[model samples]
Target chain A: MNRLFKKYEGKLPLKVINDIKEKLPKKISEAKLKKILEEVVMEYNKMLVQPGESVGLVSAESIGEPGTQMTLNTFHFAGVAEMNITMGLPRIIEILDGKKTIETPMTEIYLKKPYSQGKNIKKLALSIKETKLNEIVSEFMVNIAESKIELRVDEKRMESIGVNYPVIQKCIKASFKELALSKKGDSIILKLSEKEKELNQLFKVKEKIKEVYIQGIKGITQVLPIKKGSEFLIITAGTNLKKVLELDFVDKTRTISNNIFEIASVLGIEAARQAIINEVFKVIQNQGLNVDIRHLMLVADTMCATGTIKGVTRYGVVKEKASVLARASFETPIKHIFNASLIGEVDHLNSVVENVMLNQPVPVGTGLPGLVTKVKREPEWLKNKH
Target chain B: MKNINVKKHMLVPEHSKLTKKEIQELLEEYNLSLNELPKIVSTDPAIERFNVKLGDVIKIIRDSPTAGKSIYYRVVING
Candidate 1:
């Protein structure tokens, strides 16, 4: 075992080597171990990417080809009303484009310890779901003659959301200091403070009151606690990654938001890179497409290689290309050319795009292998004699 | 200074950058030029924590399901 381990020391990681050591039988002969190690080494060799493979192009084609066949539709979450995930091709485009604000920003929040083991999950979900004052109000009557607005809060809805009238009153008072908020049993009355009582001003205040935040975490519109195996995880419709991770009961290590830019700023570029790969793979898999994960990983790495999330668009990764011609090849060729000339930028013609654009042999595959042959020449006198 | 340990959060692969001598040895082993090798930006978060310079090579060790562990190399270039 030691000899086998030493043979593939640097070739494999220490953890894998230890695992192999543990799995080997104590009575196995040296020859048998040698054969097993050889097979393992061969398998390892097969997994490596070949030199000059043009992985970027391969990855693009692999994803793009399958993308054309994907249906453009949003998938509704199981048993969750009005919570539809932007899936299929549109979702893939959103991810690769690195849009700052996605149509449906969501997160899968895992709880820590007892919370994950199906304890107080409903309460936890209620606490995370965002509740605005407007959502719980059954009626909003604008009394223009009295210069006031009467908001009748839904008692049952408020109870279900676990928010009391006092909390709502406090939030309204803090948000709108200019307006006086008075609670009358289950309803809250809003009127202009002694300063101004114009009809227009009261109308504006009435509109603003409807949008005031009441309780619960902001940006999380809904949360559904679903049981998976022995643990329970919450799926939120809207994502506020920073705020969610701050909760003591949340499993910071496992909780993930689908917003790549948010992840990049909050967790760092590596996490964003991983999130991109996972999200892209998830979208493709949801559509029942079979694509190698390595291709997705390459795309993710390229997008986040510069320590920020950049889309595949001309404004993003394409614009960062070293070769001016390569940049021109991606999109907006005339604009790229015009800008490159103005700056006197040089095109090294090193990459595949520029070479292909110029109709020259691309620097990949067989083109990478070149030969330099020296021509043998006879002296001038010997040539004349011949 | 607070160290942002990226590995603690997710399954980040092990990244070890190769020195000049080791890079030279890798080139000889692979029988390829520096340009032929796969490129990773110098600012890539996986290797940014290390004191790596331009033209350095990085060795990435990832745990794969098919293969127990797969080793890959990338040449570090400026972003």
Candidate 2:
């Protein structure tokens, strides 16, 4: 039986063979197994991508057609109130265009082992959230005559977020080297220098002091701990994939950021390719659209083909085309033509667009092959006799 | 402790460096040169542990939702 299986291994994928083995009856005959394996190979071959199929065009239409029906609704309430994610058409555009700065960047961070089981889950979530000075301050008392701005520390709020007085003191000291701070009971008084003691300067220092970064990961503005299945995880508003992945408790393998460039830089281009597929598929699934996963995979592959994420926009994948005319036809026709002529670039008409521009049959589908036939017209004498 | 096995991730597929013989067979099977194949940077975290060099072909075995499983090949290139 083992030898029989070995014989068919080269003909079928290992997963398919393993699946068949698991599902087969113990009492099945060798001949029946052979027949089953043969049939599986036949079915697999029948379902494969055919030659001359315009897959890129098909995938484009499959995803693009559903895009028209998608609502322009930008903000999606992500169960956590006030954390709105960009979704629908605008988001699809943002992702496909490969915009560097996304409208709403976020991350879903999975914790390691026992931490994922709600062991100090709240504390962990709080620690991951960036605590601004304003969030932990109760009131700002400005001493007009003394050139001092006093910040009353909200002790209860600080304790809840696990931030101590010393941490706050350190944060302030690091941020404002010029301002001399003196600890006075629950309030920390900051005294500006005599030269910079104008009312306007005092107010500016007061406003700037409010935004001091106190603790937690820098970019993560807010973190919400929610139970996903049996495990507890965090969904953060702002994304800092590199820093978050470095934390001791974070499950680096599972944690993912919605920012494609971040993923590309942190995890590598392949992961970014997978991210593109998952993100696009998520939007399509949420919108009740049915596009084959292969289509999305093809798009992802194209975007990541050059070992970096490039959008379908003119500056990205379009700019990398081999044919000069294809690049010229996409956008800025005159500019592309001028540059091509200046460089003495040539258009080989290899792609569909260039051939179309020249009023020739596009080299795809039936036009892919060249047919050579000898026209057996009778010789001139024979034709005249007929 | 900071060392995370990248292949263990759900999104990451099984990545293995192909032998010279295997690479030659793959090239012949696809009728493509090394450059015609898709590329992965030599520093890609997924294949970092493999200690792959430039021009080495890496085979990726992915779990596909539509096709159940799919295989992809990428040549390692300098970033």
Candidate 3:
């Protein structure tokens, strides 16, 4: 046991070391222990990637091969009728492209303590759901004669969303300073200021009133509390990660948004890298496909290595390549070549793509090694003696 | 200045800047030059917390399903 511990002292993690120690027989001979340690070390070393292996190509092919077989569809969140997560091939493309705005941005918000244990989860979910003015209003009637627009509030809807009449009135007044707002019972009346009180102005005011922010978190269109592993968590259709994290009831450590770029900007690039890996893994797993997490991690590392999230496209990571020929080989060869030539850029051809483009042996695998020799002449005295 | 703690993040691997002696030992063990190894920018988020400079090497320890744990070395270069 001491021999095993000494052998793997700093090389292996403490958890792995302890696990091996617990699994081995307490009375094992020194030779047997040594043999076991050797086997474990050999297995670990074999799992490591070789020095000159093209990890980028392997990762791309690993993901791309299975990516073609993925379904092009969105998956409905389990037990939540209103929310659907973007999944499959289209979602993969969206993520790899590093799009700023995805078709459907969502977040899974885990709650802390009491909330996760099913304490007023329904009411909490309702409070978290964003309620726009148009969603809570029953109808909007524009009176041409009075040059005013009247919005009838839905009492039940407003009550359910926990928004009061005064709150709606205040929101409308704060948002639209050009219009005068007055609340009477369930209806709110809007009229343009006297100086600009044209008939056409009322229609514009009516349109603006429809988009007024009434209550709840902005950008989160819907929120549903679903039971997951005996704990209830909220899943939101739209994402507002920063705002959501600010809530006192949220488990900030576990709450995450599907949008990687948002996570990068708000959390940091490290978090963004993790988000990318998780998002990709979730998509692949949802489609019943098996992909090694290492490949996804490699891709994520490449995207976030420069302290920012960049896409694999020409405008992103490809554009940042150091070699001129490497960038030209990606897309629009002429443009990249011309731009490089204009600046007198140099191409070292150190990477695989540039060498492959030039029909040269790539500096990977067998081509990584080179032979060199030095010739020395025999001394005249030694030659004469011979 | 960001409030989010990258070190506490679940996905980020543990990172430490290698000393000069350690870097030399690593190079000798791998039979590689500084440029031959993979590179990471000095501003990379994983190593941002460390007081690393250009040409410094950072050691990253990641949890791997197949290997139990894996160690990787990357040289820090200017962005």
Top model by TM-score, which number?
2
Give the per-residue lDDT digits (tens) of candidate 3, residues A239-296: 9987887788988678888899878766656567778988999889988999999899
DockQ (Cα-based) for each candidate = 0.25, 0.50, 0.28
Checking candidate 3 for backbone clashes, the offending pairs are none
Interface RMSD of every predicted model, in angstroms: 4.7, 2.4, 4.1
List per-candidate RMSD values in Å: 4.9, 4.4, 4.2
What is residue A150's positional error in candidate 3, in angstroms? 2.5
Predicted candidate 2 versus true structure: per-residue lDDT over A1-386, tens digit per residue:
87888997767777778888899988988898889988999998888788788999999999999999998977656576789888988888998899999989999999998999999988999998988999999999898999999999999889889988888989999988899888889998999987998999999989999999988999998888989999999999999987888889999778999999888877777778889999998998988988888898998989898878899899998988998888888899899999999999988888899989899999898899989999997789987896
Local error of candidate 1 at residue A272 (angstroms): 1.9
- A best-first ranking of the candidates according to their DockQ comes to 2, 3, 1
Candidate 1 lDDT, tens digit per residue, A1-386? 68667978877656667777889887998888888888877887787778788888888899999999999978888887899889999988998988889999999998999999989899889888887788899999888788788999999988887888788888898989887778887788988776778878877887788888877788998889999888999999899887887788888778889999887766656567778888988888888999999888788878876557889888888877899888877777999899889999888888888888889988898788768888878789989997
Q: Name the lDDT value of residue A26 in candidate 3.
A: 64
lDDT of each: 0.81, 0.88, 0.82
Model 2 CA deviation exceeding 4 Å by range: A193-201, A372-386, B1-4
